[model samples]
Target: MSTESATHLRDESGPFFGEFGGRFMPESLIAALDEISAVYEEAKADPTFAAELAELHRTYTGRPSIITEAPRFGEYAGGARIILKREDLNHTGSHKINNVLGQALLARRLGKTRLIAETGAGQHGVATATAAALFGMSCVVYMGEVDTERQALNVARMRLLGAEVISVTTGTRTLKDALNEAFRDWVANVSDTHYVLGTVAGPHPFPVMVRDFHKIIGEEARAQVLELTGALPDAVVACVGGGSNAIGIFHAFLDDPDVRLYGYEAAGDGVETLRHAATITKGRPGVLHGSRSFMLQDADGQTLDSHSISAGLDYPGVGPEHAWLSSIGRATYLPITDAEAMNAFRILCQTEGIIPAIESAHALAGAIELGRELGPDATILVSLSGRGDKDVETAGRYFGVLDEAALAASALEQNALDANELTDGEAEAGELDHDAALTAAARQALDEASSRVDDLSAATGNGVER
Candidate 1:
């Protein structure tokens, strides 16, 4: 890699990166999308809107999230200097907050009364609910049944934030299905509800708009790295599910030829097997969630199911920009297996005292590989996208760190910790109304899920379509 700058930007003529992104959705959504696009374009140009958003970033979402050098962890990575962009330290404990706060403000600007979103690991759901609570907007989040199970604490957190969580039981019970449900809700309630997309994927304006919201990750990291190292990083590494954080960090460095960008995808067992979500590495261009992108699909063109130990990265499609970036040789994408990611996750926790989201762990694994190949003295900047508290149960099971008794004890300790975090007065006033609504919604969703499961079971046994 040469220490030279190579600059490029996506085409502004339309909502596209090369031939990738565009409005490939139902006509019913066009007006809503156009409205959003127009408003966002105006907001982007207005100093007042920019000032307000900047203030929110500073006081509300914690702007300029610090970059921490991970020397201990770097010891394991071919002695390369590893630095983490600490997005995990932000409010809501993830980079998701950066986008949600912007979108929530936009939603309020559009006079939307309700906010709806879909989540996989529930980071986005929790972030959206937090923003809704802050903005006093009604909120609803759709999550896959399997995801709700894997990320139960986040489901609880979203509920506690006064968001109704709907469990989608259809089709693999994961992010894609939940997204389908969210879009359905958005179309029906387009007049009053704004769909706060969780990532840099989806239709025309969404791919562009969400990426704009998260660009701060790269902008800040770029300035921070330059000040700390007096040079740009050798590689900018981030995990790619829907590719938000990766794109966020990658965008600013795209014009810097010397800064290599690498995106790691979740390879469950391996990409050669049918059980991974390495879309850019193993998939072809296809339409999913209204955007043309790399998608895991069968010969018949049906989308294939994606699997990963990390709920966040289990998706068949990728953000369209990732596909474009790969095609133009601007960025390199690779796969990191579940075992590889888990090992990196444990190493970071033990060595650096940083428990990263399993999704971010994929990037850590990639950085390790890149570090070895690039040799010592190379600096790798990895996006620590979210905190791993949400994955403690999953990680505990993976590492056998928590047995049944220990798990129970841990749960009790967590409950107590959460209780102590709330004041007696505020808890009494908020918990009553919030808990009642949350409990009712939870029960209804569970009952509906059970009924669907029963129906599926009956249909399968009788050889009928459900």
Candidate 2:
């Protein structure tokens, strides 16, 4: 990367990054945003602020998250070494806590008694709620109605953290809608509420402030990787959803000329179709969620709805820094479809005994492709951004694991409809008892499955084995 371009990426002097980010918001919220910017800048200069945040990260948020080698998963990646920066093991099970803790401390400094936030997959909401509880502040989280159903587990976690969750139903009924509502709430309650912006998008200081909070991810991972492999990774990969986690892990390696950065976006179905959240891959320069960035907009400049099985990536616009990164060729952004992401999600679960967030799975999918392209001698570091505990239901439904009993019963019923399934020619010749054969259809199916097992001596032949 050119020094000029890298400066453009790492520059924090203003709201805009190259041609991407700027303060675009309603007149009513400008003053509040400016206040946040001022407070954040002051906090940035204070050593006491850094010390306090580091202490909180160490004691509460689980700082210096570990990295683990995914050797088993590496086999699927063409034997490339897959080292995972395990942000999933953090307290709230994601990198979101890093920013939330910082912002909550800022909120306290600003004399705010409440925190207003928006969430997509609910990790940010859970994190913000946790911070609110820690600081004795009231919390309210705006979430899309669709997300509330899909990520119900995180919803429960937020409520248990003593936060009120409002389900926004307007617009696309996803992350963007929730953000719109959160902004409106901030406009109304700016005096006593701090809108803990979740990702590296939104207006002005939000993108900068959020990224600063998360830079520790890359800093620690960089040193850890150096110690583990005695070299910087050949490539660092992460999922880009509004660009927080991606920028978090990608920041430290920006100056390393040989270290490549790859960010995977959510391709709900396929990038060829409209059902995708590949902002940097499919979008053009535009404004959404208070920042001018790469956005999925129609020719008329209307922001289009984004789709993704991973709720966190379901946004039409991405952070301005990502747009800048893509424009300057400092980073590569690609689309990973739902099927591809879920396949990697399951692969990590079964192979490495680690279940990653669906959002992070996109990064894993991209890393697999890069591993094949870069060869086995290469090293790839992936940001396993969050655990899959909240995604158990979604994964179960996606893999059909939850419907196993129903699937088996349906297969048996469908098999019974085919008389030829019972015998070769006796049934056709009317030499067999149809009633008996039909009655034994389910058992026959079970027996067929059991016969394939080498240790069937302990099998009950009813889809069960001793």
Top candidate on TM-score is: 1
Q: What is the clash tally of candidate 1? A: 1
Q: Which pairs clash in model 1?
A: 6-257
For candidate 1, write residues 1-466 as lDDT tens digits.
1222124453332477778887789999999999999999989988888888889989988888999999988877889999999999999999999899889989988999899999999999999999999999999999999999999999999999999999999998999999999999999999999999999999989988998889999999999999999999999999999999999999888878888999999999999999999999899998899999899999888999999999999999999888888998989999999989988998899888999999999999998888988878899999999999999989876664535444444545555455555545574877666555654555565565455555555543321111
lDDT of 1 at 215: 90
RMSD of 1: 10.3
- Residue lDDT tens for model 2, 1-466: 5577555455544488889899889999999888888898899899999999999999987788999999988888888999999999999999999999999999998999999899999999999999999999999999999999999889999999999999999998899999999999998999999999999999898888999999899999999999999999999999998989999999888878799999999989999999999998899999898889999999999889999999999999999988888888989999999989988998899889999999999999998899988989999999999999999878876664544445456766776566555565454545257746664867665665444332433332232111
lDDT of each: 0.89, 0.89
Residue 422's lDDT in candidate 1: 56
The list of candidate 2 runs beyond 4 A from truth reads 1-9, 403-466
In candidate 2, position 117 carries an lDDT of: 91
Model 1 TM-score relative to the real fold:
0.86
